[model samples]
Structure formats: C-alpha cells, structure tokens
Target: MARPKVPRLSADRIADAAIELIDSGAPFGVNALARSLGVTPSSLYNHIDGRDGIIELVRGRLGRRYLPELPTGTWDEIVVETMQGMRRLYAEHPAIVPLLVGKTITDDAVIESYDVLATALVDGGFPDDEVLSVVAVLDSFALGFGLDYASPDDIWQPGTPTRSLGRLIATAERGDARSDRVFELGLELVLDALRLRLARLRDD
Candidate 1:
C-alpha cells in the first residue's frame, strides 16, 4: 500500500484557499480553487456541497472569530466594543466584507453574534420594533469603517494645503493610529446620538 504524493483535500483547506483569493482581491473561481488544492472540482463536493457551501464555511469561520458574549458594560460601552470587534473582523478579511454583508445568515456563529447585539439593544432601552433597525445601523457603521480602515492615509487631498486641510492631513497621517482614532471618534458620536434616542424613549 502507498499514500498519494499530494495532500488530500478537505472543506477547510478549500475555504482557506478561497479566502486567500478574496483577501488578495482576486477573482473567485471554483475551478481555480480546485486547482490550488490539487484536487478535482468533484472532490470538493465530498466534504462540502458547492460554492454556497464554501461561503457558509467562510461565514462560520468569521462568526467563530469573535465571541458573541455581550460583556458587562453600559449600553453605549457595549455598542462601542461590539462595533470595534466587528470592524476588526471585517478589516482582517477585506475581500470577504462585500460577500458577508450580502449573503443570508445560515451560520450559527454569525446568528449568535447578532443575537447578542439584539439582546444588548433591547436591554439598553431600545424598543422591540426598532431593534433590527438599530442593528442595521451598527452594521453600516462597522462595514463602512472596515473599508475606510483599509484606505490610504491621504483620503483627502488638495492641490495646495489650506490651514484646515493641513490639520486634517496631520491627523489622518498618524498611520495605524488614524484608523483607531477615526473609529473611536465615530463610535463616541454614535453613542451620544443613541443616548438622545434613549432619553426620548424615557420621556414618552
């Protein structure tokens, strides 16, 4: 008896290869993935269903990346932490950002994360009817921030720098710190807005 020279294909391996393509902003082709794995496209079906199945694998991978546990903190604090976590996750996998937001939720890990978020909002004084909307808003913030985080430092450029533009460039030029600063500042502004909403609910 003898073993094959090439490594055997598995679902995770396929998903990993697919992720590499996406993270590099390359086109995704099942045949390409199969070739990369040194296996035939039919072999991929042995461990997973097909293209959609592989996507679910990637989704679950991300869902498992972060703990769905809502930590003990004020609603604003919880939201801030949650948004930051979401941003980091998507930023790490920039290629998947677009795919993730568009796909349906079948993976438990992702669903669990959303459930925790919903629980946080409901307990934080958000109305039941509006919880989903609030969740959607947070999603927008995290997704948008993820894209912004990957952008170049000179997002804003003027031919001749004005005083205000120079100041903007200075702040934006902090390299990695710029992303952190921008995200935190936006989170604070959003939390403040949410506070006003909560107060109005109390008033009613």
Candidate 2:
C-alpha cells in the first residue's frame, strides 16, 4: 500500500511550526498548527496532547539547544555561563517568552538545568537549604533580563513629562548593551553576596 504524500505529524514538527508562528507574531492553536501542517485539528491530537504539550516541547528544545556543557570553572563562573546561555536562548525566542513566563515547567531538560544549578551551588559551599534559593534568584534575574531584551526601545513615551524623567529616558542605554551591562553587574553582585554569605556560614 502506498502512503500518502503529506508529511507525517510528530511532536518535534509541531513544535517547529509553533515556534515559527510565534516568531512571526501570529496567533496559533490546534486549528492553526494543523492548518499549517495540512492536517485537521483532531489530527494534531494523534501526536501532541494540545497547546500546552507543544509549549513544553518547545521549552525542551530550547533547553537542549542552549544547555551549557559542564564547565570546570568555579561555581559562580559556571552559574554565570549557564545564566547567560539561558537568557540569550529566551531572548532569541522573544515571541514565546511571554507564554512561558508563568507556566510551571515540567520539561526534563529544563528541570535538569535547574538541578545542575543546585549541584554547582552545593559544590561552591552553599548550604543545601540555601542552594535552591540561589538558583531561584539567578533564574529570576536571567528570565527578567530575557523579557527586558525583548522590550521595545521606546519603553516610555510620555506626551508631557518632567525634565528629570525626560533626561533619564533620553540618556538611558538602549538595546543589548544596556541589558548586558545590567545583567553582568547584577550577576556579579549576586555572586559576591553569595560568596560572602558562604564565608560567614562556614565560620559560624
């Protein structure tokens, strides 16, 4: 028996299509994705559970694509590297960032990434109870930076504003440079604080 010419649907293919639609700022769903693949909405269920499944698929894709190789640097160095990769990956997929921000992530690779963070902190002398706290803080910083990177250049457009506010807006750094400088400084400050805390705890 000859198979049909249409491509067989799968989770990866659906994730790719969804990422494309998201990149183009088009609204996507079961019907839209199926249409893109030349299949009916119900056909989508055969491969993917629904929209949430596809989102997790994409999240996993990013996890694998940008997940850092294990590095031999000190814990802080490794953390900085991982966070940088994480931020850039999300920044690259700005259209999908909003959709993912509030969802509870269940992707294995994503979870593994967090595990890696916890392990690094433990190795760096973070108390077991405090390891996840540092992980949470770094994750928040990187994700927030990702969203900031996706923001429009004109974040403020006051029709009639005060001169100080106007001067501040006029002089603020724009684009990736601004985001990078802030991220670097913020990460460094965090690492420094953690280093100090660990030293104090060790002596106690």
Backbone clash count for every predicted candidate, in the order shown: 0, 0
The residue-by-residue lDDT of candidate 1 on 11-123, one tens digit each, is 56777788887787767667777777788888887877777777888877665655456445766767877788888878788888777777787877778777877888899
How displaced is residue 128 in candidate 2, in Å?
Answer: 2.0
Candidate 2's residue-wise lDDT over 1-204, tens digit each? 799787688667888888888888878777888888888988888887788888888888777778746444788888888888888887888788877765789988788877777888898888898887788888888888877787776777788968687888889987778888878888889888888998999999
Deviation (Å) of 89 in candidate 2: 2.0
Off by over 4 Å in 2: 4-7, 68-72, 152-172
Candidate 1: worst 10 consecutive residues by lDDT?
A: 63-72
Candidate 2 accuracy as lDDT:
0.81
